[model samples]
Target: MARAGLTAKYRPQTFGEIIGQDFIKKILSRASQQDSPASAYLFSGTRGVGKTTTARIMAKAINCLNGPGLEPCNQCSSCQQITRGVFPDVMEIDGASHTGVDNVRRLREDAVYVPMSGRYKVIIIDEAHMLSTAAFNALLKTLEEPPRHCVFIMATTAPEKFPATVVSRCQHYVFKMVGLEELTAHLQQVLEKEGLEYDSEAVRLVAARGAGSVRDSMSILGQVMALGGDRLDSGSVREVLGLAGHEVYSAFFQSILDRDLVEIHKGISLVLEQGLDIGFFLQEFASCWRNLFLISQCGQAAREILDLPLEEFEFWLEMSGKMPAPRIHAGWQMVIEEQKNILRSHEPSLSLELLFFNLAYLPDLLPVEQVQIKSSESKKTSVQAGRAEKKSPAPARKLKDQPKKTSGPENRESVPAKDLDWAGFIEFCRKSPDADESLIRMLGNCTGRKQDQTLVLICGQDFIFDSIQKNGRRKIISRLAEEYFGPGLRVEFVSNGSKSNSAFRDEAMNHPVVQKIIKDFDARVLEIKKVQDRPGFPGNE
Candidate 1:
């Protein structure tokens, strides 16, 4: 027979063999030592964190023939049978496959019988959250008042799926993911026992890839060892796992710092060509920015928090010195904010390329305070230029009918109402504090012309015409128009159909307010319908 895989072959058979979850181990061990196991237990956590493994170990601890103790002796028949999964009194059920009221009823019938070869009949259910609502209901009474000889242990990756009624009847223990340091130590022990020579960095990479799951780490180690033979290195692990190396990230960052688009494009293309996992690649890229931010802000003290290799730490320290702390912080925030978008995009390659482009130009993006200062300086210069122009003589060749110019809002009142066209009216509304933003946006999709005392607004779409025709909105528009174009001015919306439906759609879509709403809400325009005036409905006069 083929040898069992590393995860199964090296499975922890005793509480001492488990790597993490110190609190859980203590409680379960004490319970077994006193022969007072709870009638039902709920073990919940992420996969590969030893929920099922702990449940099995608890079974053996309870069934050991030597005595009810803190740990099971592997030599006894009962312990050996439980370990081999053959003990008549110790049953392991797959909750996913046995998720029905009928199956639960059968289990209830079996629970009443006395143990054939052990002190208590242990029923261990793996993935217990998969059980149907009816199945859970059927087992509720059994859990609340189980037979003296019965013990139920449920292990699930998602305990939130379990009903509160079921959870309340059991001893709930949450298993935590194994810490990086502890997981690394565990892998080192496994490698030592296998007599394999491995680089410490390689081991750490494997542990990090596992992401706090002991079994996952062991599985990754197994795959690495199979291809790497008797020795292991970081390069081999990176290649095998399709992970980008430190050099790639360093070169990428260098391109960003230099603002070299060609080099940035080449680096991203190389990553895509190598078929690296984009999610993990982005994760590592984000980590680099985080490291830069930390190093720049905290100086050498960041080394302890980073826990990076000596060479890697120095490289980041050097890179951090070249970039300002604010830029580093901005880059970090940008990466974090856009990571989900990049991952969810249909064209992740293009999204990633755009992100790199933004990073390359990060220095050019000024802070809010600096922009405000520059704006104020520009206004002062313009004011001085205006004063200089006023002191100079007017051009002799000026047209007789040329309109006079105004410099600011204070001079706006000097301009004649007849000279205020549609564009001028819109600009005035924008500067007016009383104008409603929604009304301003609706007005943008309209073409206005003055005929006698009436100002007719030719709406590009039916919706715009309908919206402005409302009594409340029309009154506000009329009031604003009268204020801008002089008193007694009237406002009316007309759907002249001068533009085609497609033209109207395009104009509506291109409007600044419409575009802003679409981008801000991630929305799309489904359809635009024209509203026909109903009989007796208020019409534009």
Candidate 2:
């Protein structure tokens, strides 16, 4: 017979059918096959990781007439009835609903009795954490030594609430949030079985919004299917689910970079017109914005840092360059502030709108560092201004600070340098693979003194040099060495060495070019990291 709900119809009948709990599956399957399954199992994890499902499966397998085995023979009457929740010997209780002393009393009374119809009596209590103190005290005796044929299975999202007495008596099985790839696969199966038409993007979006809960995903998918009737396209998925479209977010990011609030509002309006969730839009937009910031900030390859399809990867890759890191990081702070404050206001749209303007001219807005930079830059500008240059009062000192460089070597030593001119080395680097100055400066962290024929640069981490080697760009660094440093000027990257003061300090930020980059990008120094070019990984000669 067809199960009533989607969860029922999609429930795992066999061990392999269960999703996102491989570790639990192995233990349960082995124990069941040996006919030595643990009497009491403490199923703990985040919601919808199949704690209850495993309990029910264990119940069915143990009472199975043909054999209490790993794989239940669904054809058997005992297995079939248990699967349908009609088995005479099995009782599934919700601790949240029946959490009083009376409930435990009733269970205590029922325990001594033998199995009425099947070989074993199984009680599966869900949300077991909610049972009252009296209920737990009352449950102690029976749980310690129940009838030979009786077994107890408890499931909870909050395992911490249960008394130490209760946990000591049972085997503990933890459920975890399902991995994205695993959840995505499970969703595809559901869609295929339901005859739902969806693309990879739609699938990924659903899985992400699901947030690692199998039941949650199924429920959301169910609601979405109800809204769309049958076929779930990405557009309908976004619409019904009130999800902001990726393109909409892309446009919003572009607007922010270009400081075009008109385009930003237009994008926001498109999402709102599509009946998007206003609060959710801000949340997802913020997240999407944050990811772009990370990618831009890190110069992380799309393929290396993110797991996305070609279209999606390309979208981020294109935006990553335009936004840059510091700007994105700065924008991220503004968005967060807007979100925190918006919760109190009655008009979320207006709050976000004002926020848009705030972030728009934010580059012009003074950060804490701008005062010092202003004092210095003003002196330089006034001296330059004396030579017949006409400008509108130097744009009102919109940029704060002299960038990192204005702080001088002492102030800037705390940050990475921006535009350090490495003489012919810089011009030479611009033509090579690691030409991006931002990247080149980060590479400087690995710089070391020449040891004989080779320049032994110790990378703080192997992954940095490993990454360069993988991109086949190591040759570029080698070529630059040959051009500037000389022939056989080997660039030997090693790991497992201590970091340098210049690398960790913002000395580079003191450079004139570094100051310009800070002003141009309108970014602030947050944190810096150094990677060692160690041996073995992307190993060297």
Candidate 3:
């Protein structure tokens, strides 16, 4: 005979039958064994972890024909009726549907009556958090002081949603998620009893997909068993769940670790070609990185943290050794920071590609220690060069002895403005406290020459010239020139011709957008050229 569905077939009838949550079992067992059981109980945990089931078991344990005991005799009429959900004394109410005060009021009225055929009247409310505020207040009086014959048990996935007053009136029991090992063992038992042929790999996959929900795991296992004929394997499980195998994530992590762009491209393409959800793939990949991180930090103990099959765990352990903690952290951080953009993007495939592109280049970023060492080396080199200059005094003496020669652009200098290195002067302005970044940038891009005693500034474009000439900038520039080149020096401004497209190219390179592109793409603007004659084609001319 085909076995009944595992969930219903193996539903725990007694505390002993429950798979996980030993602590809850102990509490309930002790309470039932007591002569005066708590009137109200609050059971809180994630879904499918036996919250509601425990409520029913509690109901039976108290009213068992064998008398109040830790174990319910299922053969007893009260136990059988409660199990069938047709018992008169045992009432199961769904808080989601009866959220109004009227529903609670009706329940309150009904709860006053004594047990019809059993020793105690049991009222169980599922999803108790869904009760409206008014409903909870209505139930409070009945919950706090129900008749001696009645008991109230409330089961909810979220205890936090309940008001403090409501929670304070009841004894609370917290249920924990079923462990992966326990869940896997449970599935194995079910498959064996059903006489189904199965691979351990398939069982592991179903357990993971269950995510601590026994009901969900049974559902997944049932589906896989039904579709996979008599035999279940990892391939069937992955196909049914529409999930990429561990190999895919392994390939991705390896590619990123190796900084191999080509391999990364191939891996991502393979993922896309398989029609996996990009968002889900990213989340899974991040989980893999997290696993690797744990492994690197925790060593062999990482097995406890990562609930993967032995093969997958071994692979992760191997990978964990290959990638250092910092690089893994950096990579994982990038994935996390970009998650919002990737999900909101219209083209997730392209986004994934770009994300991997960045991951592939992570090795190019220097670690802090390396950067500090390089900086120290550069400083040492500069110091050595300075000492070498000091050791060679002959050139300096010979230069000082030579007559100061003046040739082209002579009159511009008291220090000829031409002889004044414009680049050096711009650097000085950059270091100056009074000169802001904008002014320094503007000066850096400008070409300077001498016209009599005036320093004539030729800007690359009209816009640059206009910007600098705003406010009292002309006066500021003149004052700066006088300070640098002496009392008679003055400043004049002019713009390059509009037809000169190369106009301001040097200064324009400093624009924020251009700078961002250079920084993000590791690129630069080598040359800026414009057509000298717009009216004629270059080739024909």
> Which of the numbered candidates is closest to the native, going by highest TM-score?
1
lDDT of 1 by residue, 174-271 (tens): 99999999999999988898888989989998998999999889888888887847688998898888899999999999999888999999999999
* Residue 273 displacement in candidate 1 (angstroms): 1.3
Runs of candidate 2 with Cα error greater than 4 angstroms are 1-4, 227-231, 279-283, 290-300, 329-347, 354-541
- 1-541 in candidate 3: lDDT tens per residue? 3333768888889998898999889888888878467889999999999999999998888889996788898999999999999999999999899899999988888888888988888889999899999889888888888888888999999999999998999999899999888999999998888888889888987897898999999988887776748688889987877678888888887777667888888887887787776665676778877887787667688787776788888898888656545456667878887888988999877898898887766544321111111355674674465545542111111111112345654334444444355554565565667776556655644567655577777764454576576546678777777766556877778775354444345545654545654665475453232322223222113
Q: What's the true lDDT of residue 150 in model 3?
A: 86
Native-to-model Cα distance after best TM-score fit, residue 239 in candidate 3, in Å: 1.3
Determine which window of 10 residues in candidate 1 has minimal summed lDDT. 391-400
Report RMSD for candidate 2. Answer: 10.7
Clashing residue pairs, candidate 3?
412-416, 413-416, 460-504
TM-score of each: 0.69, 0.67, 0.64
lDDT of 3 at 267: 81
TM-score rank order = 1, 2, 3
